[model samples]
Target: MVEGDTFQKFMLDALEIRGEWVRLDDSFAELCQNKNYPESLRKLLAETTAASLLLTGTLKFEGRLSIHARGSGPVSLLMAEATHERAYRSIVNHKAEPFESDDLNHLLGKAQLAITIEPDKGQRYQGIVPLEASNMGDCLVQYFDMSEQLDTFFMFDSDANGCFGLMLQKLPDYRSIQDQDAWDRVTQLANTLSFEEVSGHDNETLTHRLYHEEQVSLFAQEPVRFQCTCSPERSLASLNALGHDEVLDILEHEAKVAIDCQFCGAHYEFDRADVNALFGLGKMH
Candidate 1:
């Protein structure tokens, strides 16, 4: 088994193809332990978390990338986020009753997947794809095919302890017959991979097992951990968005204004003085 939560990149040196692998254990456990998440939700969140880390490997950015799944069923939200340095967090919002199935179609009926990227310096971007498939991996594959026009394949599996993902993409600027054939052959072999092999083994062992005949180069693994980016400063900034009059109006009744982060459950409170200081005014009457 992989030693810890990690994300890595790999290349089929001779096939003009590139791929990414991610496995999450401790980090995932920490993400789910605090909440009394049901078995089905934990499994889905695990895959989303792994998927988020895998997508971060494909982008060059200073900020963050997030996966947001929304639907009209009992479960309304499944969100996972990861930063450039691989810090990650995830959350789920659903009905009180436990879901009967873990399948995406049943849990999130008539849903859409959104991949949003917010670079620290550049313009923000988001891509959306309808959830036509029953699994997140294939939903992401659909996003790449329709929105990015990239030949990408994603596969995911999870057990009680860890979630695993493998992604293979055809490198750009390829129009040759050899490239097409190689892409087909590589993805077909990837399909043969099973949850037992993927969830229980390390990347090197998994890679050789699938592509033993081909020359594949595996890169060093980068660690991934759960880090919620919530703080008093950010919470204060949210209150700032409420504007001066609105803030005073809220203060008129309550002794303090309170905000709690849904992801980390961190709480921030602002009394009159704090609010007055925020707007650069004296004590409010």
Candidate 2:
């Protein structure tokens, strides 16, 4: 079957240059399907989702990468997380609005955008920057430069059709982006892409338009799909975290426990007998 959305990473080892391209379809649309988001917020969340997948694919750790936005604008908070295992989740907490300005002061209106990486074996890393980028791509590029000191360029697009994005970061020990001018040229070319084209074109076609002259090597693409991490065992563990007493109280009033997985909107229901079994009151049949 043809994959819906995918993110491809390309590297020029000789030049020590690396970049990525991403397309999101069902993997991102599933999130919006669960919630009726406003046009602006939906686009923002979709872009953030595509970006999380693209950025996290570059990490070497077995952990989670989280993108968070807290703003005073019409949309207050949006978050997306992706793990090394390829599992992802996204949430937006705000009413959808038709606000169309890309200005940081206008779109987010005095807010913070944070990129956090929690590794399985090392200390968690966090980079915080003012939401000044006219778009999410610019915000991430600013974060990479300010926090990791990497020369970075990012391009992102989203619409009712789908979401697409690209990221380029110069490796360490290289000259400045200004000195080489590659960053400026690539970004300028990237800006020429329209939402309709980015959302519709394939990776090869998009690359040809942006880097036709450059010797860009496109790697084999991987399939990206919407997968939820929720399970009965996991739901029981969450109930355990809420404490046995709380579970009993919920069972007493509601007569059953119900949990709606935020990512996939899957509902899990457990009765008193199930709760008892969960607490070791009875063995499995």
Best by lDDT: 1
Worst 10 residues of 1 by lDDT: 171-180
- Can you give the TM-score per candidate against the true fold? 0.91, 0.80
Please give, for residues 214-278, the per-residue lDDT of candidate 1 as tens digits: 88999998998889999988888888898989989989999999998888888889999898888
Candidate 1 segments whose C-alpha is farther than 4 A from its true place: 177-179, 243-246, 283-285
Clashes of 1: 0
Candidate 2, pairs of clashing residues: 38-96
lDDT of 2 by residue, 129-200 (tens): 787667887788788878878878777767765787788778884573344766667667877888777656
Q: Pick the candidate with the highest TM-score.
A: 1
